[model samples]
Target chain A: MENTIITIASGKGGTGKTTVASCLAMSARQTVQFLDCDVEEPNAHIFLKPRLTREEAVSLDIPHVDHNKCSFCGRCAEICMFNALAVLADEVLTFPELCHSCGGCWTLCPEKAITTNRREIGLIKSGSAENIHFTQGELQVGTATSPPIIKAMKKTIQKNSLVIIDAPPGTSCPVVETMEGSDFVLLVTEPTAMGLNDLAIALQVVRVLDIPCGVIINRGTDVYSKVETFCRENNLPVLMKIAVDRAIAEAYAMGIPAVEAKPELREDFRKVLNHIKGVTAGERTCCH
Target chain B: MKELVVISGKGGTGKTSIVASFASLLTNKVMVDCDVDAANLHLLLSPKIEERHQFYSLPKAMINREKCNGCGLCEDTCRFEAIKESTVNPLGCEGCAVCSRICPENAIEMVDTVAGEWFKSNTTYGPLVHARLGAAQENSGKLVTMVRSQAAKTAKKLGYDYIITDGPPGIGCPVIASIGGASLSLIITEPSLSGIHDLERTIDLLEFFGVPAMVCVNRWDICPENTEHIKEICRKRKIPFAGKIAYDNMVMLAASRGKSVVEMNSRIIDEIIKVWEKVFEVLCPNMKL
Candidate 1:
């Protein structure tokens, strides 16, 4: 059987996506593969505390204008929508930070003067902890883009093992890129107005991507009814609800995974995993 | 005009809640919501759209399948792997025009997609400018720039002295776009480990841009020790540490009712008022709080 790729995402940040991803991966039945796609501010590495055995710099190709072979035709600058390249009479100036690394200039240069050079934007670290294989990406502090690093991290996905991805927050490009190829998406959200509001947007995103998804309510309370109402009306399964536990909060503050500190909660995560497997299996059967 | 942007490195850390509260306390300001990805400020402000504009930032590649040659050359040449058997994955395509330029049959063309829309709306607080990016659309940074530029223009036209912006979370392109050239930024953070880690990254990003910032810890009671640690870091960096707001369930009720914490009678609101006073002192050194 192929390993299922489950991505834990939330439209709102700090809603326990990392907490859920780490705990679920730790509590899984088999050897779990964990990929932290929240490159912008990845926190799974903090909780997992994997002894990183390997590291690689994530680089992108930026156009380097060769003055010797250059006609300075200005075609590269004309095609660049990001204004990353500017054509001068003698030289073509490049802004690597603004470059999307789409390889447009290198391929479209009629003079063939456009060569490419690699610029390191981020780093990927991989290792293992207990029965889990951990891989995470960290975007350089000053870098403005995160999707490319996320893509690089996703490339390390192992299809033969059950993979749990902690996606970046929000419903934008980075989140979209993280959730792209996953078998199922688990949305972790709180029961606040902002949580419910952002969850709706996140739900819409998953629907557009055509991925089956379930919900996990973190810090569950009776204060807000909208999240529950929205889930029921949408027919989305409420997989698990972890109540507001002060001990859990303290453990999280100390960079501890709740399932590790309180072993009993592993049962809760196991149940959630079982539910996800059941739902994913049902979808497969229906499709076949 | 001075601009104060509220940003959190981690999401759902009460950035919107704090900004909504600030909007209530502050007057003669233009409110701008730059979190175009999952915009929630509109839900709180209840703005009435006075003018709306479509935001078309990124160009998407389209394949003219009729130009007829299944060469698969474009797929091989594409770095993003956006093209698959004549179909283009709009999300993956960065619209670099490499496929259109290299296509032997001239079957591909780049067209501007309606990435999102921005609006100038009337709210009780002031004129509000906000935007919503289409789901899975790229160019969030571009849309954020558009929203800020429009907000600046509207602020000038209306003779407003300040621009209060609700910035997006994460230290990425959109977050950069929100804080660029802003007079001041108020970072709303929590006291968790992830919160502290992300806060450091966000502060580093802000310092890299040479933007002066103030810090406020929301739900500080959740982890008082971490909250104190955050204050120590701020003090070491010479960044002003605004007062902390204790956790309160009233914030949840206020959000559900589309109201700011300041509107509700809560001790958290009082702490936010003090934070606003501190921010106002930094934003307008000559003005009285």
Candidate 2:
């Protein structure tokens, strides 16, 4: 059996992404690797509540000052590209937050006083609930970048069963980092003009990345035909639609999956999953 | 003197529409669109670029072929795989300068590259600060800070007293950068499954940073029960719960025409102006207006 990696992404936010992702993760609980890559505001954990068994720190290599071997030359400070490293008449300041861990100062210093140290930006955590093996990352507060922590989270799914990545919202770098290399990308969207424009941006990103993608129009409405028409004209498949149901909202606020709160949602989500399986299987059959 | 950042943990949740309304209501307020990755506020504000400044995020490594040594050390030392064989992949190279450090031949040098541009421009309304980034660059949060700071400086200089901004959605770098030194954050959100979920996260982010924030529900009528749930959440968190905006078409009509909702003379604009009044009250408690 091939390990099919699936990514659920919606460029526009607040469009039932967490609701659908959580439902799919719960129903397909047996022997599935659920990786939540929305490290910025990872809400999947609120529902899953997995117990952590493994914890690892994510750090970057930044330069450390050794004043003893240093001349007050200030060359390292002057050469730093990101302004992460600074120098003064009596002191040198290295703001690790500004540093991308480039280690430029360490190499440029003739005195070799510059050494490198690891600074923790975030952490990777892994645990499980029932048949679901879950991992989610949290970028440290005030930290500017999320991709490094996301990279660590993705690494946990290596050689794992049925990996499903719940991507972060937006068509930015973090979203690309999560959706890249997935076997199928499920682009979730709603029925609004802003939703349509943002979906267009997400489509461009996925197409530019050369990933085959399809759409799942959540909160289905007659107005959402705009989305359907866009998908049709672009030759993008419309996989499934979860209607505008208030029960889904209540179920989520109560911290339970929609399928668990309302069994009917199971039928809808199962159809979504089956459609994905059919398409991926057809692709695999062709490859073989 | 005062800054208002419109942020929602969930993107496409009516942040720009709200910010545009606030901008139209408050003349002389310096406007900034901190949603750098995919900025859409300029579409409504219709900003005409007057000055442009390039944003150089990080330097990348370039190996000199004239002083070439094909030693495998540079390749082996690079953790980012920025140096592949003889060619340098600019995207992969994090400008770590590790290869330059490890190379005994000293053939590698790092140079600054422009990641994006920040623009200060004139609009029909007033001054605007916005930016556009190159694909896969990693300085979005920094760019947000730079824009906010510049906007604040401009506001302070002009005695504008208000720096109204539309922050990037989510609680990542861009949002955090938007939150710094702000008097208040006006979180515009919906009452959907993801809206409340993302609000919990965005509120926590603001609280962690010790910034006072309030919530405003867009499309309150679509899910009235969920809107009350949001109100209850605010009650529990001890944060002030602001008013709600009913689902309105006038807002869309204004945006479709590239105009601010406050600029419209329709029924929706009146309700939105009420929301703007609250924003002004929070930002300027002492103002008689």
Best by lDDT: 1
What is the iRMSD of the candidate numbered 1? 1.5
Per-residue CA lDDT of model 2 for A61-122, tens digit only, reads 88888888888798887766567877877677888877766556776688999899888887
Model 2, runs deviating above 4 Å: A27-30, A52-54, A107-109, A261-268, A271-288, B42-70, B81-91, B96-128, B146-161, B189-212, B217-240, B245-274
Give the Cα error of residue B6 in candidate 1, in Å.
1.1
Alpha carbon lDDT at A73, candidate 1 = 83
TM-score of each candidate structure, all chains considered together: 0.97, 0.83
Tens-place lDDT per residue, model 1, A1-288, is 777899999888878999999999989889999999888888898899999999999999999999999888888899887789998999889999999888888888888999999999999999999899999999998788888888888888776888999999888889999999888899998887778888988998898888888899988877777898999989787888998777897798889999977899999999888877876767432111
Best by TM-score: 1
Candidate with the greatest DockQ versus the true structure: 1
- lDDT per residue for candidate 2 within B97-214, as digits (tens), equals 6677667888888788887789998887789999876555656777888888888877787888778888888788778888887899999988765678788888888988888898
Clashing pairs in 2: none
